[model samples]
Target: MSASIVCSALGFRWPDGDSVFTDLNLLIGEGRTGLIGVNGSGKSTLLRLLAGELTPASGSISITGELGYLPQTITLDATRRIDDVLGITAQRQALAAIESGRGTEADFGVVGEDWDVEERTRATLDRLGLGHLDLDRTVGAVSGGESVLLALAALLVRRPPVLLLDEPTNNLDLRARRLVHRAVADWPGVLVVVSHDRELLDLVDRIADLREGEVRYYGGNFSDYEAAVAAEQETAHRLVRAAEQDLRRQQREMIEARTKLDRRQRYGQKMSEQKREPKIVMGNRKRAAEVSAGKHRNMHLEKLAEAKDRVKEAEEAVRVDEEIRIRLPHTEVPPGREVLRLSTVELRNGPVLDLDLRGPERIALVGANGSGKTTLLRTIAGTLAPVSGEVALKVPMRWLPQRLDVLDDRLSTIDNVAAAAPDASAQSIRAQLAKFLLRGRKAEQQAGTLSGGERFRASLATLLLAEPAPQLFLLDEPTNNLDLASVAQLTQALTAYAGALVVSSHDIPFLRCLGITRWLHLDTDLTEVDPM
Candidate 1:
């Protein structure tokens, strides 16, 4: 296999004292590559650098094939039609062709080969399960998930030799995720994906772990990478323990030698004084003995330092602490038995849905995109007034909105938290925020500047620690931007929460884990089922 992309001895340091990598090297061949790392480990940074969106501070990155990158955030003009967006790229290329009109007769002869361009575009759309969508549909009317699928379809039409996708499955539903997986599996070129989805990683030929700004290659899928990491950590631990043992032994031996040497020196001086031997000879013998003892002490000291250094090095080789602490606290106040009561609630151009959530029941709002799940959530949370019926929330509700509109774009994280819970003292609020890993000066950073996952966590912290706390939670797409670990953490917290939970999520496994058996499917014809 030929090398498609290569990064040699790369190093980067951002202005915020964050290190991307130091002396990192990687080689990519013609196959699917998966990038896995903890949150904020520079996986996205590396992708940006490879896509020529960001320049590295040092070292070089070279791509052998035509590269096309699909960023985590897809951007499309809201007013533009799908056909216009798709054709814009082709039109630009055709314009370039027209500008450089020095083509041979062969080019003109084969110009008719473009006859099936429309057919090919349709096929691409169908492959993505979006053939039914009108090409003339305005992007503004499309949902977030559809926008992503459309972006992918447009990129595929370019037919570059290499595809670099960053978290392609993040917001996609199960069916859309399957479509992406199929596309990656069947793609005829090099593919590199940065995703936290283990299922998606399983389709890759190799996994590249990004940590501390360096890449460690492991052959095989996610399971293999995890196994290799475990084994390596074990080895590092063993080495550390052995080094500690050797250091202890050496210290004991050194102490004994020093005590014996002291005794010998004292005895020799006493004998010399008692026997009245030649003073010079006695002094010389004593000096030689002292020199030998000093040398021995120095050697032992060097050995001890070396042993300690080895242990430190071994400790740095692997991060053995991987457990998550989900410390969610609830107040003493309990909500009434009636959580939410909705009767004859009709959403615009959508279903008339009715829901009754009693006690601490976990109910999932299940529907396709644009099916008014979020609208229903807003209505129940008292944020949006319904057009037709009434929603009686017996107890005060806390809402994690679909877009987190409560979060201020201009305020710092700490200020945002303060704004939400004005009664809580600064010290207490900071302490609570620290539990979610936003500590020290990070609380002063702008909420808008944080990553999508971090912002979600901050919003969650605000609700969990509210003063007049809400017992009923209305979560909309809570798992949209969370990493897998964070998702698990949130799941554990929600499972432990002793209040009514009404969550709308695309994560099936997460919903199942929450014991949400009842679902209200919102479509033109409303349906409710117990899909336990």
Candidate 2:
């Protein structure tokens, strides 16, 4: 029941003066905690602060035990041996010296009582399905998925009391992801993991949602968190409607009071002019009437103000995740139109492709990390050419690369969209950009500084808003680093897109949401499979 980590009045901001956290306070106890937020919501930054990788601008952090961190983007000396990654190089060297019968007292001290370090490391790696890999092999020789498992194995061997992992499941295949889930499930100490992988999040003890500059805890897995938010939003919307009606009623009552006062004033003026009473008596009556009218107007004014405040409070409680509802009749392909056809296309890895894609077909391209899925996407995007044969595209096509490098970093998002859409006016582009949640100065900010989710949104805007109105969309890992809400937004946007889609992703849920009509597994060849 004790808190393993605590933050009090924690404040931090980037060097560009962009504030991420202000007076943020949190208490993370011992549990499997899933840290989730939008791409640029400072989830990773908070982990860094807790790990002491970055210093906070203000406030303090308290920790009860040793802490370890696995960052979002791991930078490893790929050429180094696996032992070096596991922090056992010194111990292995000591053990070797002792075995050679030339060990000093210092060597014995280094080895200490932990003589089974090598065995434990091997067991951890094997449990993660990396048993086939040689312990002496360099990390550069392994696959990307293997490398992720290796990094996780590195952390597992440490057994730190407090572990912070940022996007640990990113770039991992299905098997590796399941291994990570098991690791999180079996973890005994305080573990906080930040990931977009829904399967991994399903293993957590509780969910901590970082939004609007604070953390809100939900007492279950990702599904529970989503259900809670849905219920809250429904209630908030109902309150907003009720508040709107109350405000209107208050305004109506205020106007009626003013009308009655006006009528009484006019009647009093006529009575005074007709001299219905003595001069002093009429004057006294007028004064009393003036005081009564003033009181009545003030009461109505206060009621109206109170009603307006209630409406504002109710509106503030509702989230503003606006959907992209732009209509693109120009991009819709005819039912009989031939979208793409590959004729005897020889791929890099000996896949002779003969495929035909008709109008508005949604295809999910599934493959392993090194199975040439990305290469195929680049070929379709015209960024790369196959070793032999031609990739024929009958309609205008646009590619959203896995890295999302389509945008110019130095340019603002508004400018980036304008670059892709030369024929559209700036005002028109801004209006469309607002649908992507980039409004006003946010649209004007340089693309280089946007959050991960914001960058994805900006890149998506550029592709969908291109001048030619792309009839074929080539999306690579489109939902990679997106938070759940942003992923929902992306799904809503793609639902409205009336074009053919070829998406490369391992996210089954997201692929299902796309309404994929065809499923193609790209190994040595691209072959269609049943959606089931």
Candidate 3:
């Protein structure tokens, strides 16, 4: 069997003097593999490199089979129909030819010899839970999740030997996610998936962890890999501590030896100054003591140097997890009983919905694609006026739009924070930003120049620095572009916040972790579920 992909000494660096990877080596065989790393650790960049969409700065990459890629972001034309978009026309032709029992040259060209393209298309679509999709429906009319499913369908038609997917289940619901898992398991070719979903990671045969421009492979599923990493980190920490103790002991010994040598030299000088009888004997005694002291001092110095080296080695080997410092001012305002109330709310061309939110309630809005979850949040935030409803908000609310529309590209992170938090003093605003891990000069950098994770941090700085921050937080897809570190930080901060939290996300595990007090599930209408 040939290798699916082989990358040796692969490396890449950006024009801004930032290195993504260096001297990286990887081998992908015919099996399900999971790629795990922090955001900006070059997961997507590596995928693109594998797909031949990007060139490696150095080294070599070889691929034996045809490769297909599904990027995290899919670009679909608004006017094209779903079937036309996925090349189903050829499939229809193949179907017609089979039913008529007629063989033509065009049929051979449309679909290669033995493969029944139409039957395959039907099977693939059905596996993706999209068999009922209207073939003529415009891409513009489809929801984000629908477009994602359609893109996968298009990829299925290629029937490539190697498949690379970036965040394949990002916008998928539970059912759709299960379908994707089934497809991946049934795939006969090589598969490399980059995702944060632990359930998906468990399905892979092995795990590759990207860190500090290198890939470390573990021959097991996610659970085994995670356990191994934890054990390694623990051992590293132990080594660091032991090395530190050894260095301290050596330093104390060296200090004592130096003190003894200095005292002996002083006594010898005093004896010479006396200039009494037996000058040769005094000189011999002084010289012998000096020699012994010198030898002892040299030995002590050598031990000290060795200890320092050991300490340095241990420090270099230790690694700590990254955390985001998202800090907001502590407010003492006594929140009212009713945070928000919606009565007789009806969306355009949709069903009637009513909601009552009490003090500091954490609510999760759930729905399929094209549902009015976003619309309801916007109406509550006073961005979009509802067609007909009685909406009430007791306190000031800050809305984090799905796309983070409030950020200014031209302004620096500090300047943007200053603009949103005008009432806050410069020192206070800077302090708040530091909590979000945008420290010192980074806060002064322009917002447009930051990475996706940094940009998210900058936005958080702006929102959290505001004086008397809106007690009611409305976030839509807050975890979309964040890295794993940032996601953890955000989760911790939200968990500790005392204000009312309302968010909409497709991340099932993250939502469950947030302890959503009330869940409102909407298809064409709204249905509330009790705590599970």
Give the candidate number with the greatest TM-score.
2
Q: Who is ahead in lDDT, 2 or 3?
A: 2
Ranking by TM-score: 2, 3, 1
Measured against the true structure, the TM-scores of the candidates, in listed sequence, are 0.80, 0.91, 0.89
Scored by lDDT, the top model is: 2
Q: Model 2 scores what on Cα lDDT?
A: 0.87
Q: Can you give the lDDT of residue 500 in candidate 3? A: 83
Q: Where is model 2 more than 4 Å wrong at Cα?
A: 1-3, 90-116, 335-337, 349-351, 408-431, 439-455, 530-532
Q: Write the per-residue lDDT of candidate 2 for residues 1-532, one digit (tens) a residue.
A: 4549899999999999999899899889988999998777889899999999889999999988888888887777789988889888889899999999989999999988889988998899889998887767777777777777788888888888899999888877656777888999999999999988887888898999888788899989988988999999999999999999999999999899999989988998999899888999888888998999999989999999999999999999898877767677777998868999887877776677777899999999887778878878777777778888778899999988878899999999999988898889999999999988899988999999997878888998999999899999998888887887788888987888899999888887789899999999887778888883
By summed lDDT, the worst window of 10 consecutive residues in model 1 runs over 324-333
Worst 10 residues of 3 by lDDT: 327-336
Clash number for every model? 2, 0, 2
lDDT of 3 by residue, 338-416 (tens): 8788888786647677887877778888776567778888888888877898888876678888687678989988889
